[model samples]
Target: MPGETVEASAGSVATRDARTGGGTAWLLGSELLTLFRRRRTWAMLGALALIPILIAVAIIIAGPAPTGRGPAFLSEITNNGLFVGVTAILVAIPLFLPLTIGVVAGDTIAGEASHGTLRYLLIAPAGRIRLLLVKYAGAAAFCVAGTLTVVVVGTLVGWLLFPIGPVTLLSGATVSVGDALVRLLAIAAFVTVSLLGMSAIGLFLSTLTTVPVGAMAATAILAVVSQILDALPQLEWLHPWLFTHYWLGFADLLREPMVWDNFIDNAVLQAGYLVVFGALAIGRFLTKDVLS
Candidate 1:
């Protein structure tokens, strides 16, 4: 009875300790501040802002009236934000999203190692799992921000240059401006989720290599490979499992009634990748001997 009493007391204490572990909010905040302060992050944001501007300028230079399914190209982009957003995702995800997440997450533990601060941080009261979670949360925030930046900037520029009237659907149907805007937002949200899979892959790679460059390079290579696999018609069966495959599901938003089958399947696939890779990252970080 006395031994049982001791075990119960210890269990309660452990539970309390876990609960009191500093919330993820502080870690998330710290990660965000670090990212915002970096000149490269600002530079990336600036470059993304330029995308729509360039599109607008090109349209202007060509002297073609705006054309979507309707009279204006801007209307096409807006009404079919799913298409525009997916286009942006296709372009950005391969190069930009992974690079951005890798820059931050790759630097996460390695930056600390490079600066000779990793050991000190490890020695701090925070558990390795918690610290890793903080790093991941920060990277994930960057992923969300980066994806939204592309969507918002692209949409805004497209609207400014083209007509901001009602949207014409691909099915020869028409919708009001307000309805188009709502659909665009939905599409943006979907793209954001798809981007998170890339972020998780980047973070996992970050944990594997001590050199930030190596981590970045590895992440990029993995992305490239995934894209290649997705493109192979022979590998049709594997397409649904690849994170890059569903990256275009945002296109579904443009379809009337929206195809939930592929979109939902993609979400499930991405979620599986996130969980598996995230666990591996945490496991590696926890077991790693921080000699640096």
Candidate 2:
């Protein structure tokens, strides 16, 4: 018995399965807990919440009446989940949300590497791919939370300070406050998916570098470049292919009858990015030697 390798009994195997499942659950829960416990996370959420409030106050002080022309100042600021909860999804998608997600995700793997913990993680029975997936899931969860925080806080602040009636969209269509709220939620969901692709890209980049700062900076630069490329008029043919291009597809949700063609296209494109980047991250994480 001392020299023999004993196979696990059926009861032991069942217990092991239970433990593995519990470990995964704990990993996810602990990651969320750790993220929220950080002072930076609270500070970031507070700052985002203040953006819409500050903008609403600025509009009120300026004394501009709501108009049917473009989005009313209040509506623009409270766009919530629609874009940055700002006027247009196009502007907010590139302007703020991606940067926020990038910073958090970009730091994911690299932060562990920088601290010399990645090697230990890789050595664990959970394996490198599973570890990477856990980190990705954690980062994506944070992105969703951050985006929702901005939308919910901004909307409440905007509604309290400004008018609470129908909103006029850029397309010159009118929608009731309730309808606008629904649209805003849909936009938020879309924006969350869009940012998930960015999160995956950031996570992938994070795996390629040990310096967390470098990963963060590279992700931001990539996002900025992608946004610029998305804006080019000459690249009309390539616009649909750019991840940043469809970020504003949420605008379609605001239009009467709701344009599914472009919205669905954007969703599909973003999904593609998510899949590709996630696979790349897992592949590199599994194969790369973490000598550090």
Model 1 residue 258 CA deviation (Å) reads 2.9
Encode model 1's per-residue lDDT on 1-292: one tens digit a residue: 5533443343333233334554556445545666666666777777766655565565567654355332223434433432343345556766667666657666666655654556655665556787777777777777777777877777776666555666666555677767777877776677667767776777787777677788777777777799899999999998878888877666556667665676677678778988998998888888887887
Which candidate leads in lDDT? Answer: 2
Per-candidate local distance difference test: 0.66, 0.68
Tens-place lDDT digits, model 2, residues 121-234 = 555555677667777887888778877776776677666665466767657888877888887777778778777778889999999999978888888788888879878898
Q: What is candidate 2's CA lDDT for residue 199?
A: 84
lDDT of 2 at 210: 94
Give every collision pair in model 1: 66-71, 66-72, 66-73, 67-72, 67-73
The lDDT, on a scale of 0 to 1, for candidate 2 is: 0.68
- The superposed Cα distance between candidate 1 and the true structure at residue 193, in angstroms, equals 0.9
Candidate 1 to native Cα RMSD, angstroms: 10.0
lDDT for position 103 in model 1: 72
